[model samples]
Target chain A: MSTLIVIDQAPYGFWTGREALDMAFSLAAFDQPAAMLFTGAGVNWLRKGQRPDGVGQKSAEKNLSAAPLFGIEALIADEHACQQYGLTESTMLPGVELVSNIRDVLGDHKHVVFAG
Target chain B: MSASNLPERNNEGFLEYATDWSSDVASVIAAEEDVSLSDNHWEIIEFLRKFYNKHEMSPPSNRLFVKAVKDALGEEKGNSIYLMQLFPGTPAKTACKIAGLPRPTNCL
Candidate 1:
């Protein structure tokens, strides 16, 4: 079965907890097809140049950048959502595909999981 | 400050809002970057957590990052350049994310 994971929070310091990463990868490892969608606040997770200086942990951007290697490369972002968040295509990871909206991307998956 | 800015409370009544970076979180770790989070990565995560708990903020750049790690961990694990290379992201970024605290807006 194909799976779709939607990350709706910024992947940085705001909400880059282990639960988000764990779900995204566990679904991918099932041997079933899987993809991740970054929308709303989640779009911040993909922003480039995220240096977490003075923060206790490693960089959120770097950890997010590694998502594709785990086979969760299907990063779809909503164009409208990006604008709302004051972001552009250039700010995200290279493979991230911008779509018209959530429904358009959701239409393609067999199972969808929303990760906040 | 807005109530939203207030820290979350867990069942234990402690500020338990920090997200847990369990083994489950590791699955997606590789997709975000080329680097992998091995056992050593956990060590750094723990070290970073201690520093944050003590200082109530993220560590600065590599200079202070290494020092904090050494102070928290030990000289053997406190190799500055090695830590930097292993964790491409600044310690603050990684540590804060794992801790589940609000993202530090101050970092550039």
Candidate 2:
């Protein structure tokens, strides 16, 4: 069964999203079906041109780039969150699908998890 | 040519800065692992360097490392046996070190 990992927190503001990403990576490593959903402030993770090393945090944009390689099924962002964060198609990561119906996305997966 | 001339590395011997990497440095690191560079080895190393440049992170674990290689290079070179043959120990750890990237966080 595919699992949907939800991240609603702001990128770079907390460790929760990174841990969730690790979890998703781990799942993929084990040949499991897993996907990530970015809602609320989490859409910032998809924004391009983040240079966070000066702040002592690895760039979330770069980290998330490994998702496709690691076999994470998909990266879905909430459309409202993208709007709230000023992330347009040109400014966001390539191939991130924006979805308006979170309920439908959640229903597509057999299990759903909300990252801390 | 000399240890003193090498770029700054971490306690685990990872490059402190990925930009510090070069072909000569890769040879030096490979020597430390008792792996002499070959056309086969460089193919994976170059792929790894490119992967790090694009992803900004090492494949965090061996399985993911293999998967990433398969995604890019296809199945013939992506299996654990092929990677382990090129890199004696954990292939992800050894290749990333030689490729001048950060240590894979979950390698152990």
Candidate 3:
């Protein structure tokens, strides 16, 4: 069965979001079919030019890019959320799918998770 | 190079700044881990450093670390036993330490 992970929190503010990212990577690592959905402030994760160096954190932009190579089926972002966060097609990290109807994505997955 | 002359490290001995790393620093760290710097060890270390440069993070856990190695280097060097031999203890932790990268977050 496919798993859909949801992230609603902003990046770098909390470790839980990273744990969620790690959870998503773990699922992909095991060959469990999985996809990630970005919503709310979580869409900020899809934006490019993140430099967390001053915060002493690794760039989430770079980490998310590895998802596909590790076998994640897709990284989908809510278009409304992206608009709210000021992310455009050119501003987002490449390879992410910007979707207008996230409910359809929710309906398609057997297992859904809200990452902590 | 003496440990005293080494770049700053965290409590666990990983370099505080990745730019502080060099082959000499890797050797000093490896010496503490009881691993001599063989070409095979250097290969994995270099791969990890490049991986960090590209991804800006260490593989979060041991399983992902092996998967990443398999993805990049193929099955021969990617399997756990082969990596375990080259880097004793938790291979992810040990190798990251010597490679001058951050600790794998979920390794413990």
DockQ of 1: 0.03
Tens digit of lDDT per residue, candidate 1, span B3-107? 234345443222344444343343243334345677787677666555554434344234445555666578877776667666566544444454443343233
Q: For candidate 2, give the lDDT of residue A45.
A: 89
Which of 2 and 3 is the better model by lDDT? Answer: 2
Weakest 10 consecutive residues of candidate 3 chain A by summed lDDT: A23-32
Estimate how well candidate 2 is docked, as a DockQ score. 0.64
Cα lDDT of model 1 by residue, A1-116, tens digit: 46788777765445544466556655544434678787887777778777665676556566555455445647788888888988887777687888876897788888888875
Per-candidate TM equals 0.49, 0.87, 0.85
Q: Model 2, range A10-86, lDDT digits (tens) per residue?
A: 87889999999999988887788999999999898899899987888888898898898788999999998889889
Docking class of 2: medium
Chain B TM-score, all predictions listed: 0.57, 0.97, 0.97
Clashes by residue pair, model 2:
none
> Any residue pairs clashing in model 3, and if so which?
none
- Best-fitting candidate, measured by DockQ? 2
Tell me the spans in candidate 3 whose CA falls farther than 4 Å from its real position: A13-16, A28-33
Worst 10 residues of 2 chain A by lDDT: A23-32
User: List-wise, what DockQ does each model earn?
Assistant: 0.03, 0.64, 0.52
- The candidate that achieves the highest TM-score relative to the unseen native structure: 2
